[model samples]
Target chain A: MTVVIGFEGSANKIGIGIIRDGEVLSNPRRTYITPPGEGFQPSDTARHHRSVILTVLKEALEQAGLKSSDIDCVAYTKGPGMGAPLVTVALVARTVAQLWGKPLVGVNHCIGHIEMGRLITKANNPTVLYVSGGNTQVIAYSERRYRIFGETIDIAVGNCLDRFARVIKISNDPSPGYNIEQMAKKGSQYVELPYTVKGMDVSFSGILSYIEEAANKMLGSRQCTAEDLCFSLQETVFAMLVEITERAMAHCSSQEVLIVGGVGCNLRLQEMMGVMCKERGAKLFATDERFCIDNGAMIAQAGWEMFRSGQVTELEDSWITQRYRTDEVEVTWRD
Target chain B: MTVLKRLGRRRLPIANKMAVPENDDQASKLEFSLDVPFPSARQAAVALGSLSPDREPRRGGVHKRLTLTGSVLNVKWRADEARVLRVSVNSFLDHLSLVLETMHAFSADVCEDPHVVLGHQPPSAT
Candidate 1:
């Protein structure tokens, strides 16, 4: 049984996960939240990861009931993420690998999400809608590669929601996206926002700007409430996402759609995607927060697959990067 | 001082560490360590980028490394003379403050403003 420990601090969330032979032993995560009206910055998020990583690692080991020596390997996110956070987690991963005399596997952040979703949902060869603060794409497996069928041309869907939450000074505790999701439920009016879908890509910055201006102008005149804006934003963005995913689905002729990443946890998105899938007689596959958000278990799961395929990263070559595209990785584990 | 001496004694991989010389006085290594956390590792790296250009030729008795551990800016400096260490550290802090203030100002006035996100404005330019 190959037991692997994975460290993920690619963004604001610091997660430590342990997995053994395709099963999750333990997955612990911590998110860094800034004050209201503030978006996340990379450096501060990296500090939060550094501060809590040891503690999270200890908890993960304890919960898994395994000593550091019991681990066969260490895995970390080598990303398309903020550089400092990626390096911070990579540093610990390297230290742990050296301290334990184990092999190290640097996993791609996007593939981690996809692999975990597949593991949990058991959906094989599904079209994927991977959405998060830093990324937005519609992907599908083709010729042993997770090919990007469509993507965002500007700010991601989650970034748009989070920035909208900031415009109204909402608490960012769990997430600005979650708060906006809640507010959206109470909205009685559906304020019109830009719905931009260009070919296989979508753009949100325009809608974000339009909403911000709408909030200011409408709120000043008492024509719309925050709830209305939130509702409109969710409806508009989710529709665009669903449309893009459906386009990818039609192109691939696939029957399953898997949603992964932090923003994939949104119920509204899932519902919209579900409706689209149902209309087309397709299935929708998604996992809860534990696997959807950046977490160690996903990394470990992906790393274990890579490790089993003899894809270990040498110590000197484990330097983390910020622009690792999803398709850049050679999917050796998959046929 | 003790930490700096220990750092001096420890043999770090050449790729990761640079050595600082101790002049004739055999003075105890004067060191400065500052930990500044940004909202994300990208911000910390950007701040590091602002200070890293000055450390290129590396021949001075003072040694400095701008590292981002997670999202924190870790400024580690060591020098044979306290004055040299202080000056370098102050200069780094000045650059750091400027980077941070510029980030804040950008986020406050332009980046966060409706007009910025609507376009392809880089954070540095903002």
Candidate 2:
């Protein structure tokens, strides 16, 4: 079996991981945290990756109890992320491959998450719910491709939640989403928020706009608790996601739903998805923070699959992209 | 060829057009280049890595590439107008500044070599 080490810095999180066969040996990650009322900036995020990448790599190697020469190949997140952060990680990965005389494989960020979830949870051909700060899509495997049945036409769901957290000036230490999820549990009232799902696609900007207005009113007259708004936002957005995912499942005739991404770690989203899955007589597959949140082991796992399939990126052709799509990659490992 | 005046006394040739446009219908093709040197070849590679997302096609018909040869980082920009080339170059320089500053700020924390040239140094005349 081939041993691969992966680097992932698609956004604020910089991760380094090692994988052997289908087993992830080590996954170490660091996230860039901004002050209250501020969202992540690409430049700052890129800088964070550049500064901490090596330290993270060392930690991963130590955790895996492997030397640099033990690795057979290097893999890195190639795209579908913020441009600067993606490049910063790719550079280190490329340099490491060159230094260690190993093969390099550039991986799609979204596909990495999907494949790792499948591997860890042993889900086969499930309808996938991939959600993160920069992406929201309901995908299913068809004809050797992860075809997108639905996605956000505007901002992603995580972006909506993050921005809402910012509007309310929440601490971004652990994560805005986690804090919001906690607040949502304490909420008893349901505030009406706009829910927009167009055909198979979803839109979150309108909901964000409505919440921003509500937040303004909250700031003006102190009429509502932020917990109530968080509750309403989570309930509304998760419902829309479930609705589109259910539609995609019906379209694909798939009975399993897989949630994989940063937002997948939220227990409330999982409960809502689990309820929906039970109602439809389907199964739900999900992963924890180790496999979900932009980690390198996912890239390593995906890269191992690509390597086994004889996909090696030549040094000259190892280019990074900002808009690499999930469907653009040929899923050679899957039938 | 439309040659914009040099910036700085080093006379570092920035951009030059091939056959200046005679009219609005005829587009001028200009290529500009800036070579940045880091304290180490690895740092140059880091700078090149931070530009991975630039593989996507840019608007206004501007083309750019960032490559590293040893400790030198090379950035090339091609556009139809001197204005477009300037804008692209300026934007890239701003990003490079941020990347370099970050490298400087966090280099000690990451790199074992304290003397590594992670900070922004002035471009040389060579």
Candidate with top DockQ is: 2
What's the alpha carbon RMSD for model 2?
6.8
Q: How high is the CA lDDT of each candidate model?
A: 0.80, 0.82
TM-score of each: 0.76, 0.80
- Candidate 2 per-residue lDDT, tens place, A155-260, comes to 9999999999999998887889989999999887888988899999999999999999998987478677888889999999999999999999999889999999
lDDT of 2 at B50: 56
Kindly report, for each predicted structure in the order presented, the TM-score of its chain A compared with the true chain A.
Answer: 0.99, 0.98
The sequence of per-residue lDDT tens digits that candidate 1 reaches over residues A1-335 is 99999989888999999999989999999999999999889878876876677778779989999976689999999887997677667766765565455898999999999999999999989999999998999999888788999999989898988898898899998999888889889999999887899999999999999998998999889998998898888999999999989989989899999999999999999999999999999999998888998899999999999999999988767877788989888888888
For model 2, the chain A TM-score is 0.98
Q: Give each model's clash number.
A: 18, 2
In angstroms, give how far residue A189 of model 1 lies from its true place.
Answer: 0.6
Q: Classify candidate 2 by CAPRI docking class.
A: incorrect
Model 2, B95-116: lDDT tens digits are 5654554454445443433544
Runs of candidate 1 exceeding 4 Å displacement: B1-126
